[model samples]
Target: MQQQVYHSLVYHSQSIQAWEKRWFQQQNSSYGLMQQMAWAISQQLGTLFFRQKIKKIAVCCGQGNNAGDGYLVAKYLKQAGFQVEIYAAEPGSSRDLATAVQEAKQAGLQPYSQFDFQTEYEAYVDALFGIGLNRQLDSNWQDIIYGINRQNGLKISIDIPSGLGANTGQPMPVAIKADYTFTGLGFKAGLFTGQGKEYAGKIELISVIPADTELQPIAQLASHQIQLPKRQTFGHKGSYGHVLVIGGHANMGGAVIMAAEAAFAAGAGKVTIACDAKHHTAILSRAPNIMLRDINALTVEQRIALIQQVDAVCFGMGLGRDEWAKEQYQAWFDLIQNSDLEIVLDADALWFLARQPQILNSKTYATPHSGEAATLLQKGTQEIELDRVAAIHTLQQKYQGQWLLKGSGSLILEEKLYICTAGNAGMGTGGMGDVLAGMIASLKAQFKQKIHLHEIVTLHALAGDELAKNGQRGLQAQDMKHAIYQVVNR
Candidate 1:
């Protein structure tokens, strides 16, 4: 049987609008769809309210179809015997919105122009803004959102939390903090990436329309559960794959040891820790199973010979930014650029690549956090954090390789852009990226192209999540070894 997954298509806001527009052009009624959306939401809300024993509701409406959904939702709830009041924007846009206002009024609910939110209620429905918001919120809008956030109740947003960029996931000055977001039509990419994870609480798809094959998603949510084929009974050590962990200056030994340990834990058959000679004893003491090499002694011919033997190389963990480090990077990066060796550029490797500026081969995978990505793009960390999707794409475009921009919702760009939604905040600890780098190298070496980059990323995240079961607080990256072994075996 095929493994079931929690994967879903994540579309850009523009594509959502285009899909809706196309549906309307096909002779479908826009107002009818709006009503269908509001009705579906009301049904969900009604069930939730009945369970919570909530009777009083405050519906906040703006001058858009998003507000229309709110107006209709208010009308339906009032008809269902729930006490409801509307806090609406004056002179709303669209005939659909005007008709919705009329329907609410006819149903005996009066909409007030200003929303002081002084009157307490059991629930608050945020329909003030939607995916169409392109500009930043001014003081008045910010104040309103701030006020809504201050309220103590079950806060539900209609499509998206108002003020969040539909594609970027950055808040437009401010955004609504919702307990539940009853998103319309389909899933927006913003609800899953960047700051979207913080603002968009418990998301539920309303599915207000049929899926259009013509409309393509901008990204895909990576599945949580992964299935790896069981090993052949006849296979030996070489059958799995050999991974060479390549980095560790004299001053930095733990990174290489941790990475090599992770590689072995992730099922790399034969692993080598090539670092400064000073660290070989420590590595052997820590993991006697790992083979060792001296970074300071290896010549160009020796490096080439070593590269030829390994199935994959994970470079740049704890490789310092000093001149000696630069020399090693220059030698290794030049060879890897020309070879078919599967490689993961990480940590200091990403730092060097930003300066050298080379387009990597198809076999190469580069992983960088927001700060590292900022250096690579010559942009600030703020800009990179503002739009992670764009930064990863830009990295791939510039360097021409598979890229993973590490953050809350880690993005992997390969056959398609993917978001790994599994890991927790505890994975934010130091050395996590090194663990991820090792996992990438090990999996890529064993499975090659049969497994996708996104799968490897998701698997690594799953390991992190497993370790975080105890708690997210002060979780160390070195502690992920057993978790990785358990996940890969499962």
Candidate 2:
């Protein structure tokens, strides 16, 4: 069956007025304040259903309307018989702390000192700032944010965490890493890209203003949500085609392990790993459910024979650009080009193809992070960061097929482009790229018989939003595999 995904329309603004108009429409369209309040109340009620009462909650207030959100949350929690403490700013007093102070007085919540927060609270609410933040947070504020993070409790962000830039997905020098970020209006673009994904925990948008009123320009746009295709009860294993994972060197078998595991988790019917002999056992040990093969045992003819049966192939990962790995890339390239199978190139494969840009113009996708993307295009990271859309499109035009540019906000491009508004900054850890390649490969292989490149791109982007369930911090590509199943099956 073809993978199903929900895609939202994105618009670029030439002036402030244009953005304002768009913002007003989105804010009221199921993403406004009523929606946010409903979600918040529902979540709290669920906790209450389990007989877990939130006795004490902390609200970090800021100057913007986000601070207003925190104030409101604190008031509600206090009214619900929960103890509420509001932190207007840093431990010390500031002239600019007027909004927080006024809100605190009005809500009857008291300001907290650093020493006074030794007690554990049931939950923490962040209302520091929203998507409009551009400047970096100062050192003193960073210390405060760190202190709050170190505390043991359920932390919630109103609108967005303070010190987070809602546009670039980059965090301010000091950003409050929330366990859950209640976004305002429509989804903000920056929340899912760059470091934004890691800091903005489980995200849900809340539009506080009426949908019909004029609003500010959108700081960022939310990507489409992934919806899994329904399966027929009569379907068999062949319903989902085979996925071939090609990678894993002697000491780096873990690379193929991660890739294959992700593919299988994404519901690939048959996942085969053509990797180094030394690491085959490791792959099987970690994921005994997959089919692992040794590349050393297969001749070029044998490898090609196996490749012909698979619906899609994932290249790179632990495969070094040495003689053997290079030969594998060549063989894989010839096999893919010769056949009609879908392909996804990553890691060393992308690096190898970067040396020969002509080869990239195939029915394949090159999944590269900022550094890898820059290297392939012979440009600097700054250039790619400045205009991710242009850079990815340039690469797409340079080569054929689709382009999955991994970074702050992973941009998946085909005829049109998509940006994942989910995800967090904490996703900058290792092994994420390998897992992403596996996901694309699995989805492509499963739906190889149906859908076009746009569907594949849509699935990948939407799956990203689903991965935010467990929070964006320390999110490996492997984490996304589970989310894919949930989305596809949902």
Candidate 3:
């Protein structure tokens, strides 16, 4: 199983079967059932150097074609001199399963009825269920999953983890966590968002079907990769917009620095920080290219003088709830409300507006994590987990601007809701939101493309996933700046 770095959608039973039928007909193979699936999996796996060798494999199965995938993988592994054991709890009589069983028998591999984690295993393959799974997993299955987690080897999931809701990304009361997941046919939107990332781990898609078939459904555009605009030989400093980063109270100086540095790294022609005097000195010391000023000392005339030249602004970050900051933000919002200045609202700004509810109608971008989104919706976090789409859509409709609902499957909703198809487990860290907010603001400052907002958000997510491939820690917001540049240029 491989982890997908961006938002994508795969087959959901009906779509996959339709493609498979068309494929078999085209190939003119009479015994194409398990043979075709096995051949596809093997050929795909063979393309990865890291996955070429196998010794032992543990198989988990349910009644669907996903189980068939696991059985087929097990057969392929066994034929290649790898030891494999299959486990099924009342495997049903679906045609897919029967064919898999027949193939297993031919390969001298019989599946067992029970699972034991204590058994020494090199890797585990999840086939419990697929997108059709609706109910909470049984206790026995939970125990098996728990044991699989306790194992000391790699864990792979076929299609999806047996217990994840296909439509919603919610996991059943219990779901097996796979180190990597190989999605068949197409990508599943649910596998990229909410709690989906934690369970799916590294996701790789196996598009066994031909592309000519029109059965593939576009997954929600959650995350994506944006091509960076090229810097022609004739370009100059004014090529990108000047971004004004406003935030960073006395104790939160690092926030403004991070945002400004991120903006510069993201290709801002000029980056300015409207913050405290003390922080201003630190900003110059760390990144001398950044221009810094004290917001409080800026008289009304001076404040107005500064706002006229900037093309885009990023609010919040470490802007506290202090009366002064509140007044500044409110005034800032008032000034920009009627203007066409592109805005990226995050951190305290999001919290403040969410509390006022009535003042959230401006054409700005809002970046909020699940907890922040829950607070704005005035619902428990658990309720938001039940259906992220409804909650995000509710927020998007209530607020006039694009809503980047940040979570496992960070949703990017504008006129149409898009899911991110990229990213990895390593993205589960801090300061990422700050980096994303800066990237979006910088992009708006630089380009006014019809899809600029969508493209930037996608690039940000893909960069995070790329950084994760190295390891988890040390992936700072600053690091993503170069990565973002790379993603956009590509």
Candidate 4:
């Protein structure tokens, strides 16, 4: 048998629905596709139960096709000798659901309207709502969802976690927090970005639709194994490009130093740092390979002359909002405004851009966290986090460049949106974004033939995840340097 590889192609609800309609047209009917989906779910559940030695399961059903899937799961579980109980919510909404209820009843399964919080089960299957949910849950459903969450068991959601917006990834006031989500038909963009990552845990894509169908994907999720082209064996240091890192005001020398170090670690042929003259001695002491330029001492013409020699530039790490920082930014901004130099803007650079928006080239990359993204978009941090996709699009529209929204499931908006799936919570500390900016700049410098924004972001996150293997807490930004070297070599 050929091994199956699932691409991280994500679709919205309407797109999925349209594809399903086409699939159903090719098949016998919608019910037939539903049956195939339920069968697949049952088989998957059987394997899970066997491995965990689970005997009892509670299937939470709503008044939709998702509920019908729950009913079928109940029938299959009962037939497989597991104790199955179906808890129906808002019954008599769909004929398919009604048929499923009758069939499950025939298989000696009883449907209950109310659930006891005290009752213990091996697992709970959330089929309350799927991708079609748009409004908030009512008080009755909220109570039920709350009850399910309060239960002590493995919670699995079918298709999608109930009450999560399929496109927006916004959760209802009370949404099911699933331990595992078997997303059917296709991978929904909502399951991997923004609030979706919190609600939909351990996602497994279930292919209910045909694999060869001509369905278009709205976005792609990053893969684990990334491959970069091999460098020539006889190539000299000049074969790879040089990366210039500009940041690190007086007290914030560590930010720019870390970025410069990361750039060297990420395979930049030459790494240079332009910052306050005070940190020059300290930077050389730590990283001797990194050449230093005193931004305070150098004239604007001299800085531009130096910039002209570098392949790529990374700005804003520890770059403060002071007058000195503004002067440094202005000198470089003036030289690189119309130039095709690959630029990675981060930290205070983003704040600078927010204060005064600039016309940047297509080669520019902005790495902004929620707060910085909100500043750039003129919205609140909460608003930016609420819908990251929309925020990234808005950022791209306002500023004509690639944008990376940094957080859990970091999104890269270039020609199309690509969600990074390799990072962990341990990367939440300071200086991490600076490290990412350096890595991106280094890669951009080395691979001048094409822009690898997606690959660069994925590698950065993968390095963080590799470092997080020890534990999430106290995983420093510097710890990822070795991992970055390893990933770049791979």
TM-score of each: 0.95, 0.63, 0.81, 0.95
* Stretches of model 1 off by over 4 angstroms after superposition: 1-7
Clashes of 4: 0
User: Per-residue lDDT for 382-485 in model 4, tens only?
Assistant: 88877788899899999888889988878988888888877888898988988999999998998863646877888898888889888999999977789899
lDDT, candidate 1, 72-128, per-residue tens: 999999888898999977846589989999999999988998787658999999999
Cα lDDT over the full model 3: 0.73
Scored by lDDT, model 1 comes in at: 0.89
lDDT against the true structure, each candidate = 0.89, 0.66, 0.73, 0.84
- Candidates 2 and 3 compared by lDDT, better number: 3
Q: Comparing candidate 2 with candidate 3, which one achieves the higher TM-score? A: 3
Q: How many clashes in each structure?
A: 0, 18, 34, 0
- The TM-score ranking, best first, is 1, 4, 3, 2
| Index of the highest-lDDT prediction | 1
Off by over 4 Å in 3: 1-35, 42-51, 72-83, 93-103, 117-119, 208-226, 232-235, 297-305, 358-363, 421-430, 458-471, 474-490
Candidate 3 per-residue C-alpha lDDT over 131-248 given as tens digits, one digit per residue, 9 for 90 to 100: 6676788887777778777787777777777677665677887677877777766777668677777788777776644555467553445434344546788878788888888888
Model 1 TM-score, 2 decimals: 0.95
* Lowest lDDT block of 10, candidate 4: 1-10
lDDT of 2 by residue, 247-274 (tens): 8867577777777877877778889998
Model 2: lDDT to the true structure: 0.66
Model 1 residue 54 CA deviation in Å: 3.2
Point out where model 4 deviates above 4 Å. 1-5, 24-27, 211-214
